[model samples]
Target: MHKRMAMLAFIILVVAWGIPSAKAACSTPVVNASFGSVTSFAVNSTASTSSGSLSVNCGSSLATIFNTDTISVRLTASTFASGTQAIMKKVGDSSGDNIPITVCLSVQNCGSPMTIGAPATTFNSTQLSIFLLTGGKNFTIPLFFSTQPGQTVAAGTYTTTLSFLTNWDICTGLGVGIGGIQICVIDQNGSATLSLTVTLEVTNDCTTILAPAVNFGTAPLLSSFSSVVQTISVTCTKGSVYTVGLNDGIHAVNGVRNMASGSNLIRYDIYQSTTNNRWGSSIASQRWSSTNATSVSTNQLIRNYNYTATLLSGQTTPVEGNYSDTITVDLSF
Candidate 1:
């Protein structure tokens, strides 16, 4: 009965010995990628750039008990970005032409293109599940590129600086308690930043050249062969100030273009106009300057060259066989 006469209770407070959060830093957080030496058509098509990493260095006590940590990477637009897309400006361009681009965690499988300005990009859950190792732990988050193609801008070097925010959480436990309970012993929560200097060198290119066969049609007399007044479609890079010319054909004696049949030849010439402005290989003065640039489904600026190919008058008509000549379509930009 004397056992109920006394009761003892003890409480202990360890303020100075409390468990503190771990330290976090991005020792090598640089994401560098390049499409390199691509054509303007490449900017209007689907392609992937080389990969880089969001390298992180961790120093914490989580490796002892929980042996794990976590992190999340989110995109945010910087000074060089506008809206949800990144604009790469062409170097030395007076027009300030911009090529819009995007980045992703995957290649062409970019279901969620990073809307960095909106800060609405999805975080990589699998990559965030970090397992802290002994001594030190290094976490690498790979970054890939997925551009928003169909941009018909100037051809040159396009570049921009892209940055992203990284968040990390270090925990002291494995986040699972005994009896299947949800345990959360977060030791640290920190954030950092990283950048990607992307370069896209766009060379001038001729994407499409639809030159139909120059058929003078069968003619009994050389002077009776009707001139060809068809259209030659030339699609080149947008903003490419260029000149289009026709090189001397395979059978060019002197300055006259001749279609050959065995030893026989049919003299002819291609002119920019029906009134005798010969479209020769000399682009310095005799070039057909670029006209208005129009876009097609391929996002290329297509220019139409209307030229007339006429059989030289007063020339002897060749033999009754098919006389053909190959002419090179030339461009000087």
Candidate 2:
């Protein structure tokens, strides 16, 4: 009976000694990640993305102890200055213009709603587990960005810094604070940083649609002067300053514009407004200037201008048939 009791005590000691008594120590690893600049952002850009890589070395010792690990990555929200999502804009610009941006591990990463700068906005693989093998692991995450169509913003090179945070846990079945196994928490001790740059260009553009011809049809010769109204439609980029001018008609002499029928010419003048102020070559006084300041969520803005043309009272009508002249419309922005 004494020998049996001693053998049982020895067996208990062996079993207790076989189990680990301390938590495994892991060396902090350096994460090597980088991405290039994205240059496709425009005023009409819908969405754009830049591809990058994330890789880290866990070392053989740490991988052996923690065979499997679950990892999630978070980005610092303060880096983005606009909205709930990440944004970019011209460096050193005082203007409050910005372009909305976001980051994702895959299409699945974008599915989860995340607020900028919050740790809850993390990216991880839901379908698969990340294992810390002998060699380590690498991942691919893309930065997604977008701008509204016809968005009016300052044009320049925009830059921002992206800081990464990583959280990890061991896949061991053992509970924390039991049997010498402690809670697993992997902090971003040596995460990598990427300097992201985006560029935008603002261009001035305009489209002009001319109205139908002003027909002073069948006016009685040597009768009272005839008058007609004409119009032009101009669409331009928002916030663009522009000027509109009407050149001398094809038949002109010493600034006396005329409509001709064969060899006979009838004098006429174009007024800028109903007030009868002449529309001429000078941009300061005789031309029309306006600002495309109408705020629109989408599409370019249109501005219309109307002018009146009148035949001079002193015109002596001679042989007449179909009388016409082409006046060129000029727009400068």
Local distance difference test scores for all models: 0.66, 0.54
Task: Provide the RMSD of all predictions against the true structure, rounded to 1 decimal.
Answer: 6.5, 8.5
lDDT of 2 by residue, 161-265 (tens): 555565544332222232354432222223333344433344566644555787887856746546888776776654456777888889997888888888888
Best by TM-score: 1
Give the range where candidate 2 is weakest over 10 consecutive residues by summed lDDT: 170-179
Cα lDDT tens digits for candidate 1, 44-158 = 7865365666766655334333334567667776434567677778656667567776676534457776767555333332444442334455566676765567677778887
Q: Worst lDDT window (10 residues) for model 1?
A: 7-16
TM-score of each: 0.68, 0.58
